[model samples]
Target chain A: MKEIYLDNNATTKVDEAVFEEMRPYFCELYGNPSSMHFFGGQVQGKVTEARGRVATLLGASPEEIVFTACGTESDNAAIRSALEVFPERRHVITSRVEHPAVLTQCRNLTQRGYRVTEIGVDGTGRLDMEELQAAVDDDTAIVSLMWANNETGVIFPVEEAAALAKSKGALFHSDAVQAVGKLPINMADSRIDMLSLSGHKLHAPKGIGVLYLRKGTPFRPFLVGGHQERSRRAGTENAAAIIALGKACELAGQHMDAENTTVKALRDRLQDALMRIIPHARINGGGAERLPNTTSIAFEFVEGEAILMLLSELGICASSGSACTSGSLEPSHVLRAMGVPFTCAHGSIRFSLSRYTTEAEIETVIREMPPIITRLRQMSPFGREFLKEQS
Target chain B: MWDYTPIVKDHFLNPRNVGDIPDADAVGEVGSLACGDALKLYLKLDESKDKIVDAKFQTFGCASAIASSSALTEMVKGKNLDEALAISNQDIADFLGGLPEEKMHCSVMGQEALEVAIAKYRGHEAPVHSHDHDHGPAYPDQEGTVVCKCFGITDVFLKKVIETNRLTTPEQVTHFTKAGGGCGGCIPKIKELIDEVMGARPEEPRKRPEKLSNMKKMQLIQEVLERDVRPLLWADGGDLELIDIDGSKVQVAFRKACAGCASSGNTARMVEIKLRDLVAEDIVVEEVPA
Candidate 1:
């Protein structure tokens, strides 16, 4: 059966070009980038080239890009470094809809004498700018927020939020893991003090991430071991994945226009078709500016896992914010923060598309999802009640 | 994703006796939208109302919750009312092989709804006790000192689970009862309840230092509040205030978001424990009604 993978925000399939770019490093170019021999020296030059390519994608200088294990590590390094630099500042501001990478780190900070102000979102999953404004006090060490929410696909005004943080004398960091390739980001023009992006989200392999520190930001190393990444993130570099990321970044730059055009249109086609076919299904972040190739649709009175299970049998893949779907006791925090009704929250499904996402796959989803929802709704008690109410 | 047993997946996919019985003799419902799961069970009873002749359920929850409800309806169909009441959450889970540790509440919901249906049939009504077995004759006025705020688990319930299951440790309590699973703010309280139940050490005169200096006393109170109470309150967008201490009576206040919460008294008592553990035994925390 043909497979349809629509959960790109969770992680994407690595591009074949990027994979081929990384193949040699695991075998022939196995020498360390820090080594003195010719084989190793050549690898070091390629690694530096990779850094330049990644930097180019983010509109940053190569010197400012610090490579870490993954996006979580980058987020950790940024938040921890901000705190280490400004020990006297105990307040940290972040939106309530951040991915666990930033949210969990901010939560951990609260236990260590840091006060966190999680700015709530509006009904459409848009951040309340005024609330975020009031949260960024002078005592705030940093304001960390996501560029785009992973669950809702809602885009945050990171530039405006970063500027607001800067005005309050607080460092600003954006976990741009989901937004890096799907959305246009020029760290050079923005007030973002630090920005994080993962390789995996941009069709690169996992195990590599970049923390772009706008030059002259307060510096502290979370992993203080080797002189790698200019001692900013200390460890032996993930040579292969870093090379893959470089290649992926280049491909992402080429596909960036396609993301807003073909990919966006494909997503829209799939969304509109699904919504048209399935009555009472609404988009979670449809009212706000969202990622071009992503849509989170909620089919009321139905559980997401059941829909996903039925979809899986038909070679369609997606994910849900439902408590049962996430293996958690509550629905997605993004949905809860947006005050999504319990009926919709329990059935929220995020369909994230990437360059690899084909119209055929989307068509497959459009064809397969309605029946799944109908089947699950037939089984759902709320669905029955809804039908009763309709009648 | 939860590694649900095949039986559970089977029950979830092809649930038995689904839909409502509108003209049913009795109905039992439990859980809510806010709690992320709910179940409505309808039972058709024999003329004697002593035997459950047929059963059906309508559930809004995850796969396991739906499956658990479906499994429950199937399990209790042929049994008498009393035998059905004897069926526990574990039985519902056991019927479906087993549920994930986190998904056990779904099973608990099934059992509570069954009890409620039985109660409805018997001409006595009570608020849904799906959260735990703390309601009814189990505790006077269906009231128990709530220890785990995340799952609405009461101290009475914890003690009962421990006594019945011979459980030790908060982790075991979470596994068997799901008390301190979410947020984990109630874990220290869960530990204390376990300690209280096991008779490991008396609440008073077990861990307090013999004599603490005035400097040490002040430092301890501040540290405990800062280290423990403040973070917990702050997590929920609330702030705590230490106003005045007169002898052993510590006057505390909740500020910002948590000011007028009904649970402020319970929160104050939690603060009182911190004060008692750190400084002295007879430290009473009176919330200054702010």
Candidate 2:
């Protein structure tokens, strides 16, 4: 069977165009961009040009974009940098439902005597704006929030959050790892003072990410090492990955319209069909505005691991809340935060589409999923009880 | 993804005889929805000697939890009470090679059901209800709050399972209670209670003196059989007659309730085997029907 991959939210396959663009840098153009020799200077020009392309994608000046290892590093740099800028501001504001990269960093900061006010989210996984606004005070140094949730695909109101932080005279940062390419975000117009984006989320290879620090933004150096990324982010540049990231951005810009419309339709169809076929199944964050490409569903009485395994057998690639956590034992914290019942939480599956996803692939999943669910439920002692209880 | 052992996968994918059997001889229930999982075991007994004739189960939880219950039913069926009681959680995991350590409680839950079922058949209440041991703080009064919802473990259930399993610490309670292991919200309280129960040694330890004379061993064994072991056997429609004791070996013959039981092997394991485990490992015992 042709593998039907639907877990784009987890990661995407590298685009061919982006790969071809990066191939030469791996072998032929191996000279360090920092060297002053003619051979190295030529590669430096290519690196500078790639930087400009990435800057164009985010509507930022080339000087403002600093290449980093990945989105987590970018997020850590932005948050830690802001904390260093205003040491007196001991409190920071963030949401409870952020990705672990942000959450763990916040937790580590909390351990270091910094007060972290973790704002709650509504049932739909949307931030509680009132609580967020109230959380900011004189002691609050900055506000960090994710532009899009990885699990439920719920989009936060970054513009409004930015305005809130700006009004409070606190720096605002966003982990836009899931948002940058899928949605049009302009660093020039947006109120976000700093932003982080990962290449893998936008069809670029892993290990390459960009951190955007708007001009005159209060920040401190996170990585203390050799001067690279214009002394903003230190370390030798991932020359090949950066080139691939630049090309991926170019492709993202070209395919943005198709991704929003065609991919949206495919995702919607999958959601609708899954709901129609499976009883008691519903989209997570149904009331919230989510990314067009991601759909998370809770399959009652079915453990996510069991479902994912069954899907794997059929060569259908999809992710589940239970399959993505600690030892694959804990359900998605996002689902738990939304007050999802354990009966369904363990059974939640995320089917994230991509521009590469096809109608035929979606059709195969729609046709195949119900039987798989039924088959799994039959094996479930809990599922049998749930059906009996409902009946 | 971790590759599942075929048996673990089989139990997870097609758990045997799931769902409750109404009008069952005994029912053993553990865990709850708030605790992330729960199990309900229904059993049919032969009644005459209290041998389990059939077992069915229903569970709500993760893959391992469901798999454990499924395996439990398969292990317990066709075995007499003593034989079934001897089946430990390790045996369950070993049957499938092994499960991940995080999933060890799945096997623990299986063994718990067997223990609970055996308790029910003997008309003995689970130790969870006994108010004998008073650990430090008073147990929670609210039913819902008392139970650690992540693992479906209650303080009452924890106390009982701990006593029954001879668990000495909060970690051991986790093995039996399956609490403090899920969300870990209740770990501190669980650990505190376990320490309180196990901190000070019991005034009179359950373990007999290190080395007793052969005469003393025989006298004690006779006393244990008449007081503890015999009553339990008689309640289950079985009786035992002491044959001989030779150098830590006690030979016994079956009588009354277990005279010709098809599950006599189980009865022997229960009476003879349990005697060995409870008394001393060195005190080997053999069961031969009279």
Candidate 3:
């Protein structure tokens, strides 16, 4: 079956070029970067080169980039370090629509005796900037926010939020896992003190990420042990994946605009088709300035799981509801925060296209989705009565 | 996605009966589209014989909805009025193997429509009693706390679920009674009740090296996790210890990853399946965080 993968927000396929660049390091150049030997020195060179590449992508100095295991680890490191650096500062402000990597960590911090103020987002999934400003106080340690929402692809004014945090004498950290490759993010002009990015969200392999900590930030190490990452992160370097990340970052810098244009067109086409063909269908994350490649639609009378299963049968891979999360009982917190009705929450489908997504695939989904939705809705007692009620 | 049984999937894809009767003797509709699911049933009654002649339905919602409608139609067709009324969600699920308990209400909706339609055939209003048995309080309980939003089951209903379905795990309670199935807030409650119910049952002496099939082994694992393992983890702010069986030993892990966790042995005692718990004596429970 010709599988059409549309769950880019969850994770992405490794680019062939990135994979090829990484293959040699895993085998021939498999040396511990920390070792004093020449074999290791060569690996260290590659790590330095990878760091430079990742730094270049964000317009940051190579010395400031600290590679970690993943975005979650980077986030944990940033939040934990911020809290430790300013223990007396009990107040922390953040938006409600952050990924669990930030949300759970904040919640954990709250339980550990810190007063964390979570600001809610508007119906369009935009943060309340005024409310955010009101929440931040002189005692605030940090204002941690995400660059782009993983679920809705909604972008936040990271620079503006960072400036607000800075004005309040607090540091700012943005989880840029979803934004680094897709959007134009410049670390130099931005007031962001710390930013997290994952390689998997780009074309690189998993288990490798970069955290850009501004040169003069009051940061402490979350992982303690090795002198790796300049004593910032303590772990042996994932030399191969890091090398792949560098290549992925280089490629992202070049193809970013072209991919955005192509993917946006495809996304718009898919969204238009779904709205036209399916009754009571609307984009859940509409009216927000979202990433060009993503679209989330709610099929009013159908279950999200059923829609996904049908799509799967046709080799069309996608995600839906809270069902997308393994064993999770709650729907997407981002959607819920935006006040998406529960009636449509469990029935929302996110179609996240990539740079590789084709017009043919978009056309196919447009053709297939309407019928799949219609069939599921037909099976729905809710849809039947809804139509009855309408009539 | 909810782990739907193959039978449920099959029944959903190739539903037994669908579409509305052109001239139905009676029609029944329940639930609203606003509620996220609805069912409309049409029936042709052979009044002289006091039996159902033809049945069909139009459903709006998930796979379970369509399957339930189809199953209801099959259950009623060619059956006497009393026999049709006697058909329960369990019967429909049994007819189609089994359905995920969260989806058991889908079948229950069919049963509800059937009752309403039968009452309509009798030329009387099917009094909208609060007790919508298929997903409502199946067991009489004056004081049991209500759990399972999808099914509205209680502690007594859970006990009946344990006894009737021979449910030995939290998953089974969820499947049978729809408890601990939605939002999963009541999973611990379901697990607790399973232990209490099993404790109430007379203990059978341990069977030595009993040859068990894969299905039996899965049942054991489910029971062990629900009755024995889940509650311990629940108390610790954690849950699912393992996904399924791996070779001989029952593979287990932690739900939310245990706080200050260094050992997996504490989680082993939580498994309810007697066989797996007994097997734990010989086999080591390996805990790996994924």
Name the top DockQ candidate: 1
Per-candidate TM-score against the hidden true structure: 0.81, 0.82, 0.77
Backbone collisions counted per model = 0, 5, 23
TM-score of candidate 1 on Cα atoms, chains taken together: 0.81
Ranking by DockQ: 1, 2, 3
Kindly state the number of residue pairs that clash in model 2: 5
Candidates 1 and 2 compared: the better one by lDDT is: 1
C-alpha lDDT of candidate 3 relative to the true structure? 0.76
- Model 2: runs farther than 4 Å from truth? A323-325, A328-330, A379-382, A385-391, B19-23, B47-49, B127-178, B182-185, B189-290
Model 3 stretches astray by more than 4 angstroms: A322-329, A386-391, B1-6, B21-61, B64-290
**Ten-residue stretch with the least lDDT total in model 3 chain B:** B133-142
- lDDT (tens digit, per residue) of candidate 3 on B192-257: 877876656436754434666667666765665565455555444355546557656666655433
Q: Which RMSD values do the candidates have, in order?
A: 14.9, 7.0, 12.4
Question: Per-residue lDDT of A1-391 in model 1, one digit per residue for the tens?
Answer: 8778888988899999999999999878899999989988888888999999998889889998898889999998899999999999999998889888899989988788889999999999899999988778889999999998898889999999988999989999999999988787787888899999999999998889999998999889999878888888888888999989999998998899999999999999999998999999999989999999889999988887777777776777889988777666667888988988867888889898887788888887888888877776666666777777777
Off by over 4 Å in 1: B127-290
The TM-score obtained by model 3 is 0.77
lDDT of 3 at A57: 89
